[model samples]
Target: MPPIALFIALLLLATPLAQGETDSSRSQPVVSVDFENGVLSPDWKSEGSGNATLVPEGFGAKSLLVTLPDQGSRFVHIPLSAESVRGRRIALSAHVRGENVTRPREPWNGVKVMLKTVAPGGTDYQGLMDLYGTFNWKSCGLITTIPADVTEATLMLGIQDASGKAWFDDVSLLVLGKLRSRPASPPALLPPEKLDRRTDLPRLRGVMYGPQGREEDIRKLAEWGANLIRWQFYWYDGTFPEKRLDLALYDQWLEATMAEVDRMLPLCEQLGIRVLIDLHTPPGATESRQSAIFQKAEYQKKFLEVWEKLARHYKDKPAIWGYDLLNEPAEGSVAPGLLDWHSLADLTAHRVREIDPHRAIIVEPGPYGGWGNLPFFEPIAVPGIVYSIHMYDPLAFTHQGVLDGYPVGVEYPGMIRGVLWNKEKLREILAPVREFQKDYNVPIFVGEFSAIRWAPGDSAACYLRDCIEIFEEYGWDWAYHAFREWHGWNVEVGSVKDDTSPAPVPTTREKELRAGLSKNQSARAVNP
Candidate 1:
């Protein structure tokens, strides 16, 4: 199975209530600790080997000092009643400083404050931004929109894995009101320039092809009227949130991939299918949203080298669609000082352009490309490029049951937990991407979109149809998550939506996908 995307959030900022809106936040903060009197609050509890207590010195008058005598972990946190905070945008703010803190071995190992939600659905949705090494007092906070059904929320501050001393002061929780819809307008397109080549194709429609695919699959896709295929070079598949590939193996995998593509170019040309060479797993990618490539300078160097080699090799390949820079860049994980996803993408895109200026360049936003991340996405300023995203929204719905403890029996177009979700909800969630397209005057491409096969109530098929319809309505290009990649995602292998041991039979999932892709032959694209 491919690495599962780490679900993050979009914090809707508070705006003046337009006549009908009411504020749901409490007048007073839920918790505030000055520790001035040198007494820990009864509500605050300490867990793990180390301790959190009052110390003479802090960022201000007094602070809570967290110490780990051993090289283990420790934390101090307070649980909050969820009823009052549910369905609201909440911010966790604290003044923190590290003293002799060890450099982290894992991304989560550091001095930081974390917010955890105790909800029925088991997503690791939390406010966990790690800060390592020694530093002076600094103010840091996390903001997120909490779910309506969440039972409790916890705010924890301490050290994990590599233990050390840290100080926390002026801890407080602020509750903003519920999220509101951003007003929308019709999309505006930028006038064309010499470098603009977004119209290289009429539209993109197909699946992510990988090493698992047969050469003849190109023929099958063309027969079904698919014009594009995202050929993913995902060589590092052993771990779920994959680990860094060894440098020695990198050369080997790169060669093996080039050899395979060499064998498939003609068939692709003959079938009228364009190939999007996707470096599905790049350099030091990891399951953690904070991928190693973002944290390690060495990996960043390797990342550029991969693109340089690919652009040089495939620059002249007419059947190639574009180079998907990196599958999903690990955002917010650049260590203390390093390049960010945007910088890396800009650098790589320009480097590729120096060699080949005509092919469209595709780039995706990260912490993993959910619609939520789209709002924060900083578009690359370069031209002849398409912005990319991966859609599996209502994540608890589309990717149901795949992640352990995520809610089962989830059906689409109905209430899940306390939210009424349907096609309109999908539209609301995607408004950011739509606004992005309009604001930037650039084209959008969905690199991957799909759901699990075992989703109940034909939800998988329904979800697919809804996603495709939205893509068409917006005139965005797209490719399904997979074809012949894994049986779990393969619509062809499943006869029934709920059959645990699916047998070979035509399915609604496949039918909906076929119907959607079939339209590409008749219509050029909503925009094109």
Candidate 2:
């Protein structure tokens, strides 16, 4: 045995294992990235297609060469263990060079080394060193303390969305002595009154998914007694290069969209409707590249810049409720190790507050924004901000006959294709969000929830009313899924003369919704 290995073994023998502790430290050092045998390590795995090969001409005469095709992202990674370096500071380093690499100026897509670790119960954490665009030989590394509960770690390097060549050599992982004793996890920064603001503001109810030029529809929503509108507007419609975006076209789209918003806000103010300008993009849309936006440094900057511009424009508009950051992000959607929904929300919220301090911002937990994911979100600890969630529980029921695979005849308050679904089930489904509300004490927003028009009207009404009742029970602001997007989502419309266009008039469903929402408001008023 090497002297270092013998010494580590002796040290381990001297210390007794505590209860529930594993004998994890190995006699052999975990060398994850040595290309000494002219091959990538078998312990490493690949996520996408790329020409990954061992080259003799590396930093020390051997390296891993990755040639990414003009396609989606490619990743090479190796997994490690917390037991290998528990309670110690570890460093991961690699020498790298790139050629013919290209990507959009924003929405970072590039080669990077990511250290992802998971706590015992599966809380994902990450640290990173990224290299983007074309670059000469350079060293990238990350230093992080291995938390005691961490059970797993992964080191990754890859290029995303760009046709390029990259060289990684002299890769390493090393443990430096025991870190300072500390809490097993970062404590919640929950100070009483992060800053005091109005907590009893009248709960605003409305709908999501609308573009500008719906002035008449806005008026109709006001008539229905709704006061909030989560406006889903598209800032970029045209496709750009996957690896490189055309900023000039983005500028035009921004200018045109902002101008339309300028015109629409006044109409909303006149109609007594507050607006939450929703920066929405359907998943996989060019602008809502949930996969790439957080990783690219330029993209991160641009996202903040867009929010800042909106904040500056609506700084004084009390009717403009807040900025709903991204529509619904997903798990594993962000660039590895760079940023996650929580990090993005914290950054964007702080930036927007700096620009417009009083407006209440709404942030949602990702993995498609369902209530179950709420527990994963860390509190932003900012006052005057609300946590948002979308509800489509028993989607088998609410989405019956509309969404694909749901087919018809899936009923609520009864069996949904052999599975019983009722209001009780709904409450159980929402338990996580309820727990989050209790834990965080932040305001809640049911930003989107509804049954499709194809659903039985009476049953759908029962479901919708139940949702509103639950929201009110918790004092949460609520909104239907959409206003002027799809005829099926409109309670007032059984069908549309033009399904592609908005239904301009109220249908029977609208009357029921208006009545239900008004009842909710009345109950709140009586108790408020």
Candidate lDDT scores, in order, read 0.70, 0.62
Q: Write the per-residue lDDT of candidate 1 for residues 138-253, one digit (tens) a residue.
A: 66554445665788777777888767898887776665433444336644564322113454466678888886557668877887778888988887455433235476677777
User: Where does candidate 1 clash, by residue pair?
Assistant: 241-287
Across residues 334-453, which tens digit of lDDT does each residue of candidate 2 receive? Answer: 334455556667888898888987888888876456675554345676667788888986766777765434666655677764446777777877876776766655677888898877
- Worst-scoring 10-residue span by lDDT in model 2: 1-10
Q: For every candidate structure, what is the RMSD over all alpha carbons to the true structure, in angstroms? A: 9.4, 10.5
Among all windows of ten consecutive residues in candidate 1, which has the lowest summed lDDT?
Answer: 1-10
Residue 332 lDDT (model 1): 34
Which ranges in model 1 have alpha carbons more than 4 Å from their true place?
1-43, 46-76, 79-114, 117-124, 127-153, 156-187, 190-196, 237-245, 495-502, 523-528
